[model samples]
Target: MAEFIEHNLQGVDSAILAVPVALAEGIVWEDLARMVKDEKMAGNPIAGLIDKLHFEKNCMIEVVLALSAHANSQRWYELKKSQERKQGKTFTPHKKAFKLAEKKIHLQLSQV
Candidate 1:
Protein backbone atom coordinates (compact mmCIF):
# COMPACT_ATOMS: atom_id res chain seq x y z
CA MET A 1 0.00 0.00 0.00
CA ALA A 2 2.83 2.36 0.84
CA GLU A 3 4.51 1.46 -2.44
CA PHE A 4 1.30 2.16 -4.31
CA ILE A 5 0.92 5.54 -2.60
CA GLU A 6 4.53 6.46 -3.30
CA HIS A 7 4.21 5.52 -6.96
CA ASN A 8 0.96 7.40 -7.41
CA LEU A 9 2.17 10.51 -5.61
CA GLN A 10 5.17 10.79 -7.87
CA GLY A 11 4.84 13.69 -10.36
CA VAL A 12 1.57 14.69 -8.67
CA ASP A 13 1.37 18.43 -7.95
CA SER A 14 -0.14 20.58 -5.20
CA ALA A 15 -3.69 20.14 -6.50
CA ILE A 16 -3.83 16.84 -4.63
CA LEU A 17 -3.82 18.63 -1.28
CA ALA A 18 -7.54 19.44 -1.49
CA VAL A 19 -8.51 15.83 -2.06
CA PRO A 20 -8.11 14.60 1.52
CA VAL A 21 -10.16 17.51 2.84
CA ALA A 22 -12.83 17.01 0.20
CA LEU A 23 -12.99 13.32 0.99
CA ALA A 24 -13.00 14.14 4.68
CA GLU A 25 -15.94 16.48 4.15
CA GLY A 26 -17.97 13.39 3.29
CA ILE A 27 -19.47 12.27 0.00
CA VAL A 28 -22.52 10.22 -0.82
CA TRP A 29 -21.76 6.65 -1.74
CA GLU A 30 -23.78 6.89 -4.92
CA ASP A 31 -21.79 9.92 -6.05
CA LEU A 32 -18.52 8.19 -5.30
CA ALA A 33 -19.63 5.04 -7.10
CA ARG A 34 -20.71 7.14 -10.04
CA MET A 35 -17.33 8.85 -10.14
CA VAL A 36 -15.66 5.47 -10.32
CA LYS A 37 -17.92 4.29 -13.12
CA ASP A 38 -17.91 7.55 -15.06
CA GLU A 39 -15.35 7.81 -17.83
CA LYS A 40 -14.64 11.50 -17.40
CA MET A 41 -12.36 10.88 -14.41
CA ALA A 42 -11.18 7.45 -15.59
CA GLY A 43 -7.50 8.27 -15.35
CA ASN A 44 -7.70 10.94 -12.68
CA PRO A 45 -6.01 10.40 -9.34
CA ILE A 46 -9.14 11.21 -7.36
CA ALA A 47 -10.94 8.57 -9.33
CA GLY A 48 -8.22 6.14 -8.45
CA LEU A 49 -8.72 6.89 -4.78
CA ILE A 50 -12.46 6.39 -5.20
CA ASP A 51 -11.85 3.11 -6.93
CA LYS A 52 -9.42 1.99 -4.28
CA LEU A 53 -11.88 2.79 -1.52
CA HIS A 54 -14.62 0.92 -3.30
CA PHE A 55 -12.65 -2.21 -4.10
CA GLU A 56 -10.08 -2.53 -1.33
CA LYS A 57 -12.32 -4.05 1.31
CA ASN A 58 -14.48 -6.30 -0.79
CA CYS A 59 -17.31 -5.12 1.44
CA MET A 60 -20.73 -3.68 0.69
CA ILE A 61 -21.06 -0.31 -1.00
CA GLU A 62 -22.21 1.42 2.16
CA VAL A 63 -19.22 0.17 4.10
CA VAL A 64 -16.80 1.20 1.36
CA LEU A 65 -18.40 4.61 1.13
CA ALA A 66 -18.28 5.10 4.86
CA LEU A 67 -14.64 4.13 5.00
CA SER A 68 -13.74 6.42 2.13
CA ALA A 69 -15.51 9.40 3.62
CA HIS A 70 -13.74 8.81 6.90
CA ALA A 71 -10.32 8.40 5.31
CA ASN A 72 -8.89 11.81 6.17
CA SER A 73 -6.98 10.46 9.17
CA GLN A 74 -7.25 7.85 11.91
CA ARG A 75 -8.91 10.36 14.19
CA TRP A 76 -11.54 11.02 11.54
CA TYR A 77 -12.48 7.36 11.66
CA GLU A 78 -13.02 7.53 15.40
CA LEU A 79 -15.07 10.69 15.04
CA LYS A 80 -17.13 9.19 12.24
CA LYS A 81 -17.68 6.05 14.23
CA SER A 82 -18.90 8.14 17.12
CA GLN A 83 -21.27 10.00 14.86
CA GLU A 84 -22.48 6.76 13.35
CA ARG A 85 -23.07 5.30 16.78
CA LYS A 86 -25.19 8.28 17.69
CA GLN A 87 -27.08 7.89 14.43
CA GLY A 88 -27.37 4.08 14.80
CA LYS A 89 -25.35 3.23 11.72
CA THR A 90 -22.57 0.65 11.97
CA PHE A 91 -19.08 1.79 10.99
CA THR A 92 -16.82 -1.17 11.51
CA PRO A 93 -13.39 -0.87 9.88
CA HIS A 94 -10.97 -3.68 9.17
CA LYS A 95 -7.23 -3.25 9.72
CA LYS A 96 -6.50 -3.34 6.00
CA ALA A 97 -9.09 -0.68 5.35
CA PHE A 98 -7.46 1.64 7.87
CA LYS A 99 -4.05 0.97 6.39
CA LEU A 100 -5.30 1.78 2.93
CA ALA A 101 -6.98 4.97 4.12
CA GLU A 102 -3.93 6.02 6.10
CA LYS A 103 -1.69 5.48 3.12
CA LYS A 104 -4.06 7.53 0.98
CA ILE A 105 -4.05 10.32 3.52
CA HIS A 106 -0.28 10.20 3.67
CA LEU A 107 -0.11 10.43 -0.11
CA GLN A 108 -2.42 13.42 -0.27
CA LEU A 109 -0.63 15.18 2.59
CA SER A 110 2.71 14.64 0.89
CA GLN A 111 1.53 16.83 -1.96
CA VAL A 112 1.09 19.72 0.45
Candidate 2:
Protein backbone atom coordinates (compact mmCIF):
# COMPACT_ATOMS: atom_id res chain seq x y z
CA MET A 1 0.00 0.00 0.00
CA ALA A 2 1.17 3.49 -0.73
CA GLU A 3 1.52 5.88 2.14
CA PHE A 4 -0.82 8.82 2.16
CA ILE A 5 0.59 12.20 3.12
CA GLU A 6 -1.68 15.08 4.06
CA HIS A 7 -1.00 18.71 4.74
CA ASN A 8 -3.05 20.44 7.40
CA LEU A 9 -2.79 24.14 6.84
CA GLN A 10 -5.68 25.13 9.04
CA GLY A 11 -6.34 28.88 9.18
CA VAL A 12 -3.93 29.47 6.31
CA ASP A 13 -5.39 30.79 3.10
CA SER A 14 -5.04 28.50 0.10
CA ALA A 15 -3.85 31.47 -1.96
CA ILE A 16 -0.49 31.12 -0.21
CA LEU A 17 0.00 27.73 -1.82
CA ALA A 18 0.17 29.34 -5.25
CA VAL A 19 3.49 31.03 -4.71
CA PRO A 20 5.49 28.06 -3.41
CA VAL A 21 3.91 25.52 -5.70
CA ALA A 22 4.30 27.81 -8.70
CA LEU A 23 7.96 28.30 -7.90
CA ALA A 24 8.45 24.57 -7.51
CA GLU A 25 6.64 23.85 -10.76
CA GLY A 26 8.52 26.62 -12.60
CA ILE A 27 5.32 28.37 -13.62
CA VAL A 28 5.00 32.11 -13.94
CA TRP A 29 1.88 34.06 -12.98
CA GLU A 30 0.59 34.32 -16.54
CA ASP A 31 1.18 30.63 -17.23
CA LEU A 32 -0.39 29.64 -13.94
CA ALA A 33 -3.42 31.79 -14.63
CA ARG A 34 -3.81 30.22 -18.07
CA MET A 35 -3.40 26.73 -16.64
CA VAL A 36 -6.02 27.47 -14.00
CA LYS A 37 -8.39 28.68 -16.65
CA ASP A 38 -7.83 25.57 -18.75
CA GLU A 39 -8.36 23.35 -15.74
CA LYS A 40 -11.59 25.13 -14.85
CA MET A 41 -12.78 24.61 -18.42
CA ALA A 42 -11.93 20.93 -18.04
CA GLY A 43 -14.15 20.78 -14.95
CA ASN A 44 -11.49 20.74 -12.30
CA PRO A 45 -13.28 22.14 -9.28
CA ILE A 46 -10.11 23.09 -7.45
CA ALA A 47 -9.08 25.41 -10.25
CA GLY A 48 -12.18 27.50 -9.67
CA LEU A 49 -10.95 28.26 -6.18
CA ILE A 50 -8.24 30.49 -7.56
CA ASP A 51 -10.86 32.81 -8.97
CA LYS A 52 -11.98 33.78 -5.48
CA LEU A 53 -8.47 34.26 -4.19
CA HIS A 54 -6.92 37.66 -3.63
CA PHE A 55 -3.71 38.68 -1.90
CA GLU A 56 -2.55 42.03 -0.63
CA LYS A 57 0.27 43.67 -2.57
CA ASN A 58 2.61 43.45 0.41
CA CYS A 59 1.81 39.79 0.93
CA MET A 60 2.56 38.97 -2.69
CA ILE A 61 5.85 40.83 -2.56
CA GLU A 62 6.83 39.03 0.62
CA VAL A 63 5.98 35.65 -0.88
CA VAL A 64 8.07 36.38 -3.96
CA LEU A 65 11.03 37.52 -1.85
CA ALA A 66 10.74 34.48 0.39
CA LEU A 67 10.66 32.18 -2.61
CA SER A 68 13.75 33.86 -4.05
CA ALA A 69 15.58 33.43 -0.77
CA HIS A 70 14.57 29.77 -0.67
CA ALA A 71 15.94 29.28 -4.17
CA ASN A 72 19.19 30.96 -3.27
CA SER A 73 19.55 28.81 -0.16
CA GLN A 74 18.86 25.67 -2.17
CA ARG A 75 21.54 26.60 -4.70
CA TRP A 76 24.03 27.36 -1.98
CA TYR A 77 23.29 24.06 -0.27
CA GLU A 78 23.73 22.11 -3.51
CA LEU A 79 27.02 23.83 -4.31
CA LYS A 80 28.39 23.20 -0.85
CA LYS A 81 27.28 19.59 -0.94
CA SER A 82 28.99 19.05 -4.31
CA GLN A 83 32.22 20.68 -3.18
CA GLU A 84 32.27 18.60 -0.04
CA ARG A 85 31.61 15.44 -2.05
CA LYS A 86 34.55 16.21 -4.33
CA GLN A 87 36.83 16.53 -1.30
CA GLY A 88 35.45 13.33 0.24
CA LYS A 89 34.33 15.23 3.32
CA THR A 90 31.13 14.85 5.29
CA PHE A 91 28.37 17.28 4.27
CA THR A 92 26.88 17.63 7.75
CA PRO A 93 28.40 21.04 8.25
CA HIS A 94 27.18 22.24 4.90
CA LYS A 95 23.67 21.07 5.72
CA LYS A 96 23.80 22.90 9.07
CA ALA A 97 25.08 26.05 7.43
CA PHE A 98 22.30 25.94 4.87
CA LYS A 99 19.71 25.55 7.62
CA LEU A 100 21.15 28.49 9.49
CA ALA A 101 21.23 30.66 6.39
CA GLU A 102 17.66 29.71 5.55
CA LYS A 103 16.54 30.58 9.08
CA LYS A 104 18.24 33.96 8.89
CA ILE A 105 16.65 34.73 5.55
CA HIS A 106 13.22 33.82 6.89
CA LEU A 107 13.77 36.02 9.92
CA GLN A 108 14.65 38.94 7.69
CA LEU A 109 11.59 38.32 5.56
CA SER A 110 9.38 38.28 8.65
CA GLN A 111 10.77 41.63 9.77
CA VAL A 112 9.63 43.29 6.54
Candidate 3:
Protein backbone atom coordinates (compact mmCIF):
# COMPACT_ATOMS: atom_id res chain seq x y z
CA MET A 1 0.00 0.00 0.00
CA ALA A 2 2.96 2.30 0.41
CA GLU A 3 3.40 2.04 -3.33
CA PHE A 4 -0.18 3.16 -3.76
CA ILE A 5 0.23 6.45 -1.93
CA GLU A 6 3.70 7.47 -3.02
CA HIS A 7 3.65 6.09 -6.54
CA ASN A 8 -0.04 5.62 -7.37
CA LEU A 9 0.42 1.90 -7.86
CA GLN A 10 -2.72 0.16 -6.62
CA GLY A 11 -1.09 -3.16 -5.94
CA VAL A 12 -3.44 -5.94 -4.83
CA ASP A 13 -6.99 -6.21 -3.59
CA SER A 14 -6.04 -8.64 -0.84
CA ALA A 15 -5.15 -5.93 1.66
CA ILE A 16 -8.80 -5.03 1.91
CA LEU A 17 -9.55 -8.48 3.26
CA ALA A 18 -6.19 -9.08 4.84
CA VAL A 19 -6.13 -6.04 7.11
CA PRO A 20 -9.30 -6.64 9.05
CA VAL A 21 -8.64 -10.34 9.28
CA ALA A 22 -5.20 -9.53 10.55
CA LEU A 23 -6.75 -7.31 13.18
CA ALA A 24 -9.04 -10.13 14.21
CA GLU A 25 -5.97 -12.34 14.40
CA GLY A 26 -4.54 -9.88 16.97
CA ILE A 27 -2.55 -7.52 14.80
CA VAL A 28 -2.22 -3.97 16.04
CA TRP A 29 -2.92 -1.28 13.45
CA GLU A 30 -2.35 1.77 15.55
CA ASP A 31 0.88 2.08 13.67
CA LEU A 32 -0.97 2.35 10.40
CA ALA A 33 -3.30 5.02 11.70
CA ARG A 34 -0.45 6.92 13.26
CA MET A 35 1.61 6.73 10.11
CA VAL A 36 -1.34 7.76 8.00
CA LYS A 37 -2.08 10.67 10.26
CA ASP A 38 1.54 11.72 10.29
CA GLU A 39 1.92 11.34 6.53
CA LYS A 40 -1.26 13.37 5.94
CA MET A 41 -3.89 12.51 3.33
CA ALA A 42 -2.91 15.11 0.69
CA GLY A 43 -6.59 16.12 0.74
CA ASN A 44 -8.56 12.85 0.96
CA PRO A 45 -11.37 13.68 3.38
CA ILE A 46 -12.37 10.17 4.41
CA ALA A 47 -8.84 9.03 5.10
CA GLY A 48 -9.39 9.51 8.79
CA LEU A 49 -12.10 6.86 8.86
CA ILE A 50 -9.54 4.09 8.82
CA ASP A 51 -8.32 5.21 12.22
CA LYS A 52 -11.82 4.97 13.63
CA LEU A 53 -12.38 1.55 12.09
CA HIS A 54 -9.18 0.34 13.64
CA PHE A 55 -10.50 1.25 17.08
CA GLU A 56 -13.83 -0.48 16.57
CA LYS A 57 -12.16 -3.62 15.23
CA ASN A 58 -15.57 -4.86 14.22
CA CYS A 59 -14.84 -5.95 10.64
CA MET A 60 -18.49 -5.37 9.79
CA ILE A 61 -19.52 -4.89 6.16
CA GLU A 62 -19.83 -1.13 6.48
CA VAL A 63 -16.50 -0.98 8.21
CA VAL A 64 -15.02 -3.00 5.41
CA LEU A 65 -16.59 -0.75 2.83
CA ALA A 66 -15.31 2.33 4.58
CA LEU A 67 -11.81 0.93 4.77
CA SER A 68 -11.85 -0.07 1.13
CA ALA A 69 -13.20 3.27 0.05
CA HIS A 70 -10.61 5.10 2.09
CA ALA A 71 -7.78 3.18 0.54
CA ASN A 72 -9.19 3.54 -2.96
CA SER A 73 -9.88 7.23 -2.54
CA GLN A 74 -6.42 7.86 -1.16
CA ARG A 75 -4.85 6.04 -4.06
CA TRP A 76 -7.04 7.94 -6.48
CA TYR A 77 -6.08 11.25 -4.93
CA GLU A 78 -2.40 10.47 -5.25
CA LEU A 79 -2.83 9.50 -8.88
CA LYS A 80 -4.65 12.73 -9.59
CA LYS A 81 -1.93 14.76 -7.93
CA SER A 82 0.69 12.94 -9.93
CA GLN A 83 -1.11 13.75 -13.13
CA GLU A 84 -1.13 17.40 -12.21
CA ARG A 85 2.59 17.37 -11.60
CA LYS A 86 3.22 15.60 -14.86
CA GLN A 87 1.17 18.20 -16.67
CA GLY A 88 3.10 21.04 -15.10
CA LYS A 89 5.86 22.86 -17.02
CA THR A 90 8.77 21.45 -15.13
CA PHE A 91 10.00 19.69 -18.27
CA THR A 92 9.20 19.56 -21.95
CA PRO A 93 6.84 16.76 -22.98
CA HIS A 94 7.26 14.71 -26.11
CA LYS A 95 4.74 15.17 -28.90
CA LYS A 96 2.61 12.22 -27.79
CA ALA A 97 2.81 13.07 -24.13
CA PHE A 98 -0.56 14.81 -23.95
CA LYS A 99 -2.36 11.89 -25.49
CA LEU A 100 -0.63 9.38 -23.25
CA ALA A 101 -1.09 11.45 -20.11
CA GLU A 102 -4.78 11.82 -20.80
CA LYS A 103 -5.13 8.08 -21.20
CA LYS A 104 -3.25 7.46 -17.98
CA ILE A 105 -5.33 10.01 -16.10
CA HIS A 106 -8.46 8.38 -17.47
CA LEU A 107 -7.30 5.11 -15.96
CA GLN A 108 -6.59 6.87 -12.69
CA LEU A 109 -10.17 8.09 -12.57
CA SER A 110 -11.38 4.51 -12.68
CA GLN A 111 -9.34 3.41 -9.70
CA VAL A 112 -12.18 3.34 -7.21
Question: Can you tell me which runs of candidate 1 are displaced by over 4 Å?
Answer: 10-26, 39-41, 54-112
Q: Per-residue lDDT tens digits of candidate 1, residues 1-112? A: 3233334443222223433344567955456456555733667544444333333543232232233323423444566677889665433456567889999999999999
Q: Using lDDT, give the best candidate's number.
A: 3
lDDT per residue (tens digit) for residues 1-112 in model 3: 3333333223223335545555677757776455446544664433433334445744422233334545655756677789889877455566468779998999999995
Q: lDDT per model, in order? A: 0.46, 0.50, 0.51
> Model 3, residue 82: what's the lDDT?
92
Among all windows of 10 consecutive residues in model 1, the one with the lowest summed lDDT is: 60-69
- Give the distance in Å from residue 14's predicted Cα in candidate 1 to where it truly belongs: 8.0
How do all models score by TM-score? 0.29, 0.33, 0.25
**Candidate 2, residues 38-92: lDDT per residue as tens digits?**
8779986456434432233423322222333344345456666788787655567
Backbone clashes for every candidate come to 0, 0, 0
Candidates in order: C-alpha RMSD to true structure: 20.5, 17.6, 16.9
What does candidate 2 score on TM? Answer: 0.33
* TM-score winner, 1 or 2: 2
